[model samples]
Target: MQIRLGGLETSEVAALLAEHVEDMRRYSPPESVHTLDLDRLRTPDLTFWSLWQEDVVLGCAALRELDPTHGELKSMRTSHAHRRRRVAAALLDHVVAEARRRGYARLSLETGSPAEFAPARTMYAAYGFTPCDAFGPYVADDFSMFMTLDLADQPAR
Candidate 1:
């Protein structure tokens, strides 16, 4: 699969993002939901990416610079057609590498706590992200699971 910076033009990338929003609606309550829609993803502080193969959008992810040393993962979604094929994994790896390259000392994320999110939690665990208390503008919510990964010692590969 190929991953590249995405342009906002209602393309496959937009479709994947729309799916992410739908997933949020399905799995998370309104108050507990934390997702960036297309407009938010286009903000100056965030860098969005799209993963594609041929002409199909396989998945997408985004990095939001919360501060100089910390980065937040956002809009990570694997298309239903590409589920379980490591599309999300590749996008995540790309974001982590990009964060390290940008000199971020830590990478953090917030995902749902429902059963629909168990797989996502496991995937984060596999990448060395451990559960943590709320950070940034986020507040403590039982439906939310915050995780962090320290990037201090790991060299970019």
Candidate 2:
């Protein structure tokens, strides 16, 4: 599969973001839903990407700059048909590498702290992310699980 820079023009990407937001709503309370909408994802600070194989969209993810040395992983979603195919992991690997390329000292994310999000938590753990206190504008919330990876500590993957 190939991964490319993503914009808001494609219908498939639009649909994916719609489904992602809907799923987040279904799984979390309104106050706990942190998934970005299309407009929010288009912000200058966020760089989005789409993973594809020939013509099929496998998944999409984004990295939002929190500061010069930090980034937040956003909108991580693998298409239903692509689940268990390692699409999310591949996309994450790319994001981490990009963070390192950008000289980011850390990469962090916030995911639901429920059973529905267990797979994501496990995957992030496998990539060296560990539970951490919230950063950026985030506040303490039981429903949100924050994780971070220290880019400086990682040997080349």
Candidate 3:
């Protein structure tokens, strides 16, 4: 699969993000869903990317800069047909590599604590992200889970 930057204007990417947002709504309560819609994702602080093969998109992910030393993972979604094919893994690897390249000492994320998000939690854990208290503008919520990875502590791969 090939990963490229910025497909926000494309119909396929828009549909994928729409599906992702709708899936979030289906699992988490409205107040607890923290997904960034397409418009919000277009902000300068965030860089969106899509993994594609030829003309078809397999998945997408975003890396958002929180500050010079820290970054946040956002809008990670693997298309329904691409699930379990390592699309999320590849996207995450891209995000982490990009964060390190940008000189970020750490990367973090916020996700739901519900069963619907268990696979995501497991994926993050496999990438060395540990559960942590809230960060950025986020607050402690029983329905939310926060995780972070200390890039500085990671051995070069």
Candidate 4:
């Protein structure tokens, strides 16, 4: 899969993002839903990417800068047809590599606590992300699982 920077013009990316928000709404309470909307993804500090194979969009993910040295993983979703094929993994590797290039020491993310999110949590763990307390605008919530990875221990990509 080829991973590259994306913009709002990518309809597949927008569709996947909508699916992500809808899924979050289904699994999380309104007050606890933390996914960013399309507009927010356009922020200067957020770098969005899409994974594609030929003309097909496999998935999309984004990195939102929480600070100069830290970033939050956002909107990570692999298309249903692309699931179980390492699409998400590729997107994640791309994000982590970019974070390292941007001089970020830490990469953190928040996902749902439900069984529906088990695969996502597992994916994060496989990439060396360890559970952590809520960072940024988040508070400790039983329905949320927070994780972080330290870039210091990682070699250049």
All candidates' lDDT scores? 0.89, 0.91, 0.93, 0.89
Candidate 2: regions farther than 4 A off:
none
Which candidate number has the best lDDT? Answer: 3
Model 1's alpha-carbon lDDT is 0.89
Q: What tens-digit string does per-residue lDDT give for candidate 4 at 19-104?
A: 88898999999877998888988989888888889888889999999999999999998888789998988889889988998999
**Per-residue accuracy of model 1 over 1-157 as CA lDDT, tens digit each:** 8998975564777777788888898887898988887788889999988888888888888999999999999888898999999998899999999999999999999999999999999999988899999999999888999999999966564
lDDT of 4: 0.89
True lDDT of residue 135, candidate 3: 96
Q: Which ten residues in a row are the worst by lDDT in model 3?
A: 148-157
Against the correct fold, how does model 1 do in TM-score? 0.95
Residue 127, candidate 2: how far off, in angstroms?
0.4
User: Which candidate do you rate higher for lDDT, 2 or 3?
Assistant: 3
C-alpha positional error of residue 125 in candidate 2 after TM-score superposition, expressed in Å: 0.3
TM, every model: 0.95, 0.97, 0.97, 0.94
Where does candidate 3 clash, by residue pair? none
